[model samples]
Structures are given as structure tokens and as C-alpha cells.
Target: MQPSTLDVTAERPTIASVVRSARPALGLYVLFQLLAFGVLWLLSWKAGVSPGRFVGAFDGNWYLSVAEHGYDQAVTVGPDGMPAENSLVFFPLTPALTALLGLFGLPLLPAALTVSLLAGCAAAWGLFLLGRDLAGPRVGILMAVLWSIGPGSAALHLAYSESLLVALVAWTLVAVARRQWPLAGVLAILTGLTRASGSALVAGVCVAAIVAIVRRQDGWRPWLGGSLAPLGLLGYLGYVAIRTGRPDGWFWLQGGWEMHFDFGRFTWIQTLEGLTSNESSWITVTALFVVLAVALQIWAWCTRLPLPWQVYNTLTVVIALCSSNYFQSRARFLLPAFVLTVPLALLLAKLPNRALAILLTTGALVGAWYGAFLMAIVHLNP
Candidate 1:
């Protein structure tokens, strides 16, 4: 039998329906943000730190500097006439957006805040769309609300690339599901430009496309979409190389920052032994968390879920864990950790309304607390 065209009147919910459907999730998301803000404020007060102190802290300074001044290879050199890894660390997208926003007379801090918030909202909307595609409209709203209230949401308030990246990835996945190959590829490429981990999306899409080709599924669209995923990432890396007169300049910079990926492979036993030491408690904890996340991905894969979604998520977790340069704070870097929510959403759908409400409330509290602590640390230290 021929597949019927999607009925818009049947699939698209009314505005009133969407709002009424989203109310519970929206309320919970707001509560999550408020709680996070309150907790962070309290922590800052106790630590004798001001909330403003956290505004443009950590890597935010680098991005702001890059926005004010375009790329200069000389900027990578420190007082010792040696290139500092952190100097070349700026990614193109964030600074470019900052510069664009500055045309309107907005300061860097405010611009960052505005862009991040908008990106975050866009991400939530994308997640909602993805959920609606994969599960149902109700689940879609739940997924969006959960994402908005998750620990990762804190990235929106920072000058980091997480919010923008999440928005791109979520929408890219949505496009993939709809078989909009070119759109998926375009978003995937943008995602690559957003962050290093974005390469995982490229890989995932490419794999999915290859699988489709091998199985003789719809051909041209998948191939085109998959092919475009790595272009933005590779193009930017090439630009960095040309500017630095070193083909591997980007890789070198990542290494200089001690983000080396080979430590686990080259010194496996020693790495494990070191991690067991008291001084390496943080490393041990991070390793454990990464392992747990990887395990979750494996479980998802084994469960025979949708092939494309499974591949996308599994690759993301693998890259986060096995990639050469590992950071302890990377525990939160698993922003794609929201993939776990797919299953969680399904489970919640089957639960009683009261139970689902309780679970969402608990998740919001945890997410808020995590976000607050992250902000405090980044601000106070950086």
C-alpha cells in the first residue's frame, strides 16, 4: 500500500492546544531556572562573590576579546614568545555572532546573554519538535521542558557554545527524521563550526547516510545531507591552518591546552593507576561518569531503538569519552546527554500523571542545583 501524505490538519495542533499542552512543562522549566538563579545567588553571597563577577568569566573573556578584535595569529604568542594554546582557542561562530550583535550598540556581555537565551529557547523548541516526531506532541513538550530545566541549560547564561550547538543539533536531528537531507546537512555543518564535539554529529549523519545507501533506501537526499555534515568544521579548521602557516595548527593548540586524547590509550595502565590515587580523585570521578554515560549509550543501542537516533547518540557519547583531550568538567559537556530523555519520556508517558509530575519536579530541582554550582565555579575561578 502507498504511504499516505502527512495530513497537516491532523498532525499540527492548534495554538491553544499547543499552549495548553505546554503549560505544565513551561511552568516546571521556569521553576527550574528560578531555583538555579536563587541557589547561585546564595552561593555567591556566601563566598563573598558578586553575581556580576560570573557574567563574563572563564572562556567568556576570550570570546569577548575575539569579538572586539578579529583573529590574529600573533595573539596566540605569550610573553615567552611561545604560542599559548588558549590563544587560538576561540571558535569562529560565537565571536562572529558577538560581532554581528555589536552592530546594534549592544555590549558583549548583554549580547552574549541575549544570544545564549535565544539559542536556548530555540534548542527547547527544536527538542519539542524532535519529541513530537519521535513520540507524540505531549512528549515533545515534556522533552523541551526537561531540556530547558536540565543542567545543560546553564550553558545559555554563559558565553559558551553549548546553547547554540544544542539548538543546531536538535533541529538537525529533526530535519533528518523528516528526510530533509539538505537542511540536516546544513545544520550539521553549522553544528561542526560551533564546537569540536560537533564532529560526532557529522560522523553520525554520515553513517546513517551510508547505511541508507547500502540498504538501497532513498538515495540522493541522504547522500547529500550526510556529505555536508563535515564541511563547516573542516572549512574552519583549514582556515585556522592557513592563518597559522601550519596544517595542524588547530590540533596543536588543542594539545597545548592539555586536551590530549592519547593519554588513555598510550598509558592505559598508568592512567588507570594515577586515577586511583587521591590526587586524581577528580579524574577518577570524571572517568566513572563517562563510563556510565557510555554504558547508557550501549544499552540504548542494544535495545534496537531507531537506528539513526541510536547511532547519533552512541557516537556522541563515544567521542566525549574516548577523545584525546579529556577535561573533568566535561562531565557536564555531555550536553547531548539529553538523548537519555527519549527513553525517559516514553517511560513517563506510561506513568500516572501524579508520578510523572513528581519525576519532573525532581529533575528540575537537580538540574537547577547543577546549573547554579557550575556557574559559581566557572565565575569564581575563572
Candidate 2:
């Protein structure tokens, strides 16, 4: 007897599953990105700003400068007597890619944007891989879509390190989940090379390595991988130290940019100021998301997310949020904290098609508009 149509359709295909059945997620990510960027480009055109000027605003300009000219002398100083927006604070990976592209005769800003766009796609693919492993194909697609349209998502398209860092971090975590220690180590190193948040990835890998050792898996691989995980971050810091001839040069340079880590006291002050001050409502919006992120970190811990993911996500949020100033960019900084989306993805995955469509449609519309506004109206770059 032949199988019924239902049985036949239900049986998974064997020969061509398309990257082991992640095509849907990849397609969805691409679709959402195209739609959102199309809207942003339309807005930029209306405002008479070119894509390069619009996308490579703020730190994008800094990265481009670093790529073209390398680090400049720190002669400029702000009122706080700190280094003023120097290039030393940025990690080398994204800028290095931009510089390499420039060697092929590409313009500096365009090369940075190209690197960011490619890295953003990679990040989306990695998110799909991890999301698929966590749930199923549709859930994975939803995760990718949500990320592409999430707050600060457009920063993925801009010349920011977030794109490459997220890609490296997501794939690193995926490797951790798969117990591929060597791969995880390499990605973790690259992650550290991409952004300061690479510290979180290194910590996550260390946690995973320790967990493996505690589970009685006697292996030199775990120790060796753990040892290599932090080299990218530590090595960069060492380079900065030598360049500045100070053990604390990086932090001092960040201070010149009106940025510093103050152990959450500064964040609490900002939150309180936003809540109490009436000069602007957007301040409160930033505070709300900061609070929401903290809550989600707690919620993730309570949920079934892996220990490594939990550690990494929490540390990333802590570092990203508990810093000095830049309240406007807090939401953008939270874009790659993909672990926070797991519970929402699980809940959305079980919803009816109509409900899921409504929720995601709302998210896409709102996120795209908000990001465009940030990209166009303010000095803030998404």
C-alpha cells in the first residue's frame, strides 16, 4: 500500500534539505532585512542624506577613520580631561576587514558598510543555527527575523562591530552547544577581536569548559580551548597598553569619549534621571528597555536556556548597559543579546498563525520606524 498524502508530506526529505534544513530561517532573515533597509533607504533619500552618510554615522565614522589612517595621536581632550573619541577604544577585526577592502580600491565608508552588511548576514545565519537547535526550524526563523528587526537592528547594517561580534558570538555559542570546543575557541577569539563584548563570549566558553571538566570529561581540549578563548581580548588590551604606555590606557581613552564603566551606579542615576526629568520622554524609553533587559536576564536564568548562554547574555547586558552615558544607544547595544529572545520565540512558536503574524508584523513595523528615526533624526547611529 502507498503512503497517504499526509504521511508522504510529513516525511522529511533526504537529499536536499538546504544547509541541513535552515533555508527557511535564512530566507526570513533576508526578507526582513531587505524590507527594513528599504524603508530606511527611502527615509534617507527623503532627508537628502546618502546611504554612506546615514549608515556610517557616529562610531561608523570612527571605524572608517581607524581603517584608513590607523590610530591617531590622543592630543584632543574633552572637558573631563580624558581622551576625546580616539580610535583606540575600537577592536581591530571589523576595521581590519574595512582596511582590507580598501586595498582592493573600495572607498573607506563603503568598505566599512560592506563589511558590516556581510557580517550582519553571518550573524543572522549563526542565530538561525542556534535558534534551530533550541527549538525547530520555524522558531529559528522567527528568532532570526526578530533579531533583524529588533531594536538597534539597523546597526547591523551600519559600520559597527556589533555585526561581526554577534556573528562570532552566536556561532561560538552554537559550537559550545555542539561540544565542538576547538571551533568554539576559534570563534570566541574572533569574537573578542570584534568588540568589547567578546569578553562575555570568552567568559561563556570558560564556563562551558569548566562545566565539562566538572562532568568528569577528562580532556586537554577543554582546558586548551578555555585558555585560547580570552587571548583575542587580552591580546588587544595588551596592545592598547603598549600603544598608550599605560596599563589602563583603554579605560582612560574611553573616559575621554565620556564613556566609562561605573558598576551600575551611573545606570541607576540615568534611570532615575529619566524617570524624574521631564525634558524628554525618550530617556524614559531607554530606561524602560534597560529595566526590561535586566528582567529578561533573570527570566532567562529561570528558563531552560543553557548555562553558557545565560552567563554570556547576562554579562553582555551588564557591560552594555552599566556603562557611562549613551543612553540612547542602549537598545541598539541589546540587539545581539539573542538569548533573551528564546522564551519569546518559544511562546510565539506555539501561537496560531494569525497571532504570530500579528505579533511579528507589529514588531517589524515599529522596529523599522524607530531605527530609521534614530538613523535619520538624531546624531545617534543605529
Candidate 3:
């Protein structure tokens, strides 16, 4: 029987079909997350450490503190009468979601982990969409896999807020790519509320909006979305100003943690020291990651991806590298810059299936080892 041309045309794939085809990427994302999680748990147990403590330490503890007790009205003072670190430095959305889950009878730690798991999955889905739209379905799946096994992905399974921010940023970018301006703006607002990196997302949205406006496309929506984008971050900063009675209240509070943008001066100095001098293995490894991140960013730039991705990735790396935060935490700070993995994914997608499987397994195992090591052995924040 001969098929009519109209029938063939009607059978052409739709947008919904394309989206549904990304399920394997989402499935693989969940698989690697669980596998790495199990490996870390076993190693933690073998080392006489509690898995809960491993996942709930460092910034996780601060998030738990915020969940249990809301933010302090004012920053505390140290013994030297200096402003000390307080819950205000932590973003509110992660802990707020944790506390909301606690109301449903889930324990605090479990609730926090639940938020991470859900947000991580959401982030993976959005990553798949971005990669798929940018290149193809294979690139999309590979991007998800690369991100799952990327450095500092352990935080995706922990109580940290990186997953939440990544989820928002990914979907916001996806929205921008699809010209869903209002959705992009709403997600940008949420991203702003999630962390200081929200500024990067807002900047990306504004750039996309501005481009659309200049092109005379999408009319008032771009203006509306762009106008709404920064409000969440501004609102939070304004609230902090009211609380601290200073115009730079957010920046002032961040001083307690020694976190500020310094145009990469601190990073360059510390990285050079770690590479040239006697440093702990972890410190040397961190320095190597710093180098690798910069190289990857350069590679991503050469790919000449979309403007939103470029803006977001550049700002994210700049924020991570230029900050005076703990050097060991720089890799973790870059986890949200998933676009940097796109170049790697493109290269890896050319491999035959069996070879690709072996390489991916090896990468996942290394990621698992690093995750366990950081959580159980290293005393510093990841």
C-alpha cells in the first residue's frame, strides 16, 4: 500500500515528540546520580563515617541551620567584635523548601536531600533540552551524562543549593532559547533568589531580551520579562539592607566569609602557590581543577554557542574564579556552568557505543571516588 504525501507530512515529529525523546537523558542522569551516591555511601561506611554526616556537613549544615531556625535579624559578632558569619549569607529558597517539606513529617536532613534530588533531576532535564536544541539528541544525552559525572556533582546529591540554582538557570536558558520570555524572566527571578549567581542568570536573560528588542521581535514581552528579571535579587538585597541598615548589607555580611569578587587576583595567587609549592594533595588537585576549568571555558567559547549560554557561562566562571571564597570550593562553585561540558560531550559523542560505555564508566568511577574523598576525608568545604 502506498502512503499519501499528506499522511507522511502529518507524521513528521512534533515538538512534544522531540521533548519526549529526551527521556533517556533524564533516565541516565538519575542512574549516574544513584550509582555515585551508592559508591560514596559504601566508602563512607567503610571509613567508619556516617553517610548522613558526609552529605550534611559544611554548607549543608548551614542550610540545615537555616531550615531549623530562620535567618537571624542581624549578623552576629565574633569574640573580636567583628561581624561573624550568619544564616543570612545562605539563600533562603533551599532552606525554605526544606522547612516546607519538614511540615509534611519528613526529617530535616531527608527533606533537604529530597529537595536536592528533585532539583538535580529537574536540572538534568533542562540540560538535555538545551543540548538537544543546540546540537542534537546525542549531544543532549551526552551533556546530561557529562554533567552527572562532572567534578563537584556530589553537591547535586547533597543538601546544597547548587542544584536549585542550576535547575532554574537551565530552564531559564531553555525558555530563552524557545522565546518564552515571561517564563525565562520568572525563572530568572527564582534563580536570583537561589544564590548570588542569580545575577549571572539575570544578566543572560537581559542580554537575550535586549537582543530580541533590538530585532523588534516579541514586542512587549521582552520588555516585561527583562524588567521583571532582577527584582528577586534586588528585593533580597533591599531586605538585607533594611535588616543590616547599610546599602551594601549583603556585601557587608559576605565579608565574614571572606567572599568577594576580586577579578581573579586571589585565585591566580593561590593557584600558582599550590602548583609551585608544597601543598596538600587536595590543594594540588584543586589547583589542577582551576586550570582545567579555565581551559574548558576557553574551549566552550570556541564552540560559539548561543549568546545566552555564552553570557551565563562566562559570568558563572568569572564569579567562581574571581571570588575570594575557599579555594577548595571553586570546582563546586562551577558546577552550574554546565555549558562548559558541551564541548567535551560533542567530542565524546563520536565514539562507538562500547568504547563510549567504558569511558563513561571510568569517568563515573573517578567522580564517585572524588565525591567520597571530598565528603568523608577532606575537612574543607566542597
Best candidate per TM-score, number? 3
lDDT of 3 by residue, 1-382 (tens): 1111111112446878865887888788888888888888887888788777777778899999989988854577787765688778787889999999999999999999999998988888888877776667787889888888877788888899998999899889878877789998898888988998889899999998999999998889999889889998998888888888888988888888878889999899889988999467777777888999999999988885888888989999999999996987888888888988988988887889899889888888777777777777775667
lDDT of 2 by residue, 1-382 (tens): 1111111113444646636676766676667777778778777787778655677778888888889888775646667666676788888999899999999999988898888877877777778767766666666777777777777777877778887888888888877776778888888888888888789889999998998878856477788778889999988988898888889878877876678787878778888888788456566766776787788778777677677888898898888887877778888888868888877777788888899778887787677767776776554655
All candidates: TM-score? 0.83, 0.90, 0.93
Which residue pairs in candidate 1 have backbone atoms (N, alpha carbon, C) closer than 3 angstroms, thus clashing?
A: 259-325, 260-324, 260-325, 261-324, 261-325
Count of clashing pairs, candidate 1? 5
**What is the clash count for each candidate, in the order shown?**
5, 3, 0
Instruction: List candidate 3 segments past 4 Å from native.
Output: 1-19, 79-81
Greater-lDDT candidate between 2 and 3: 3
Sorting all predicted structures by lDDT, with the top scorer first, yields 3, 2, 1
Give one digit per residue, the lDDT tens place, for model 1 in 1-382.
Answer: 1111212234666879766665655555556666666766777787688867775777777777878887764636567555676545567787778889999999988887777767776777777766766667676777777666654455556676777878888888767766678899999988888887788778777876787788786779888998888999998889778777789877767765556565245233434654676365444544554555566666555553445666667666655555554354454566665675666566577778798778877876665555556556433221
**Poorest lDDT segment (10 consecutive residues) of candidate 3:** 1-10
Against the true structure, what is every candidate's RMSD?
4.5, 5.5, 5.0
